[model samples]
Target: MVGVSSARDRISLRGIRVTAHHGVFDFEREQGQEFVIDVEARLDLAPAASGDELAATVHYGELAQEVADAVRNDPVDLIETVAERIAAVVLAHEAVEETTVTVHKPQAPIAVPFDDVAVTIVRGRA
Candidate 1:
């Protein structure tokens, strides 16, 4: 079925834009830039779907706030680290079995012209 959701479903939140200080260059760190994040969380949707209960699933509103806090609080030199941090936050939720995170540095300090620079990482429970 095209619209049917299975037990194993993915909830994705993309284009989470925020300004944070993170980069290898000193100037880049000092002058904060907008960072975009995309996150996908895979989990069992059966409970939430069947029960129609808020407690049965992860609250995306809380997740977004937490993700924003995760990016804003920590000052790291690499986007890879930021991605990892985000994955950690997603995995922190009990319902999430796995998570994929992408951190984009649109205003990256590069001499040559470029659209964007981003780092992606996947993490799951062990």
Candidate 2:
């Protein structure tokens, strides 16, 4: 684990879009849908930064892909669940000290016109 020396460093990614089939309705799984994910992580990486190693910090590219993969690969009932799951996934990285995740659904089948529906969650180490 990284020491307290390198505290409160953060990595953030915004507006990462992924096509997914996530909804409570059965037809949603059959027809599919689209989602946008935003992610941020706080990591302690003084050890890795001082040592100059790729292993020292969380890879944002890998994280973006992982978010996309998770959204596409899994079908769930709600965006809230997706956000929670993503928070857990990001915090699982050893370098990460805390994580925040947001899932957005723009094309929700609502009669009224609105920008989007979103869920945001924050998680950290025990």
Best-fitting candidate, scored by lDDT = 1
Q: Whole-model lDDT for model 1 versus the true structure?
A: 0.90
Residue-by-residue lDDT tens digits, candidate 1, 1-126:
245544359889999998999889888788888999999999887778788998988999899999999999868999999998999999999999999999999998789999998989989999
RMSD of each: 2.4, 3.0
**Per model, how many backbone clashes are there?**
0, 0
Off by over 4 Å in 1: 1-8
Cand. 2 TM to true fold: 0.86
TM-score of each: 0.92, 0.86
Clashing pairs in 1: none
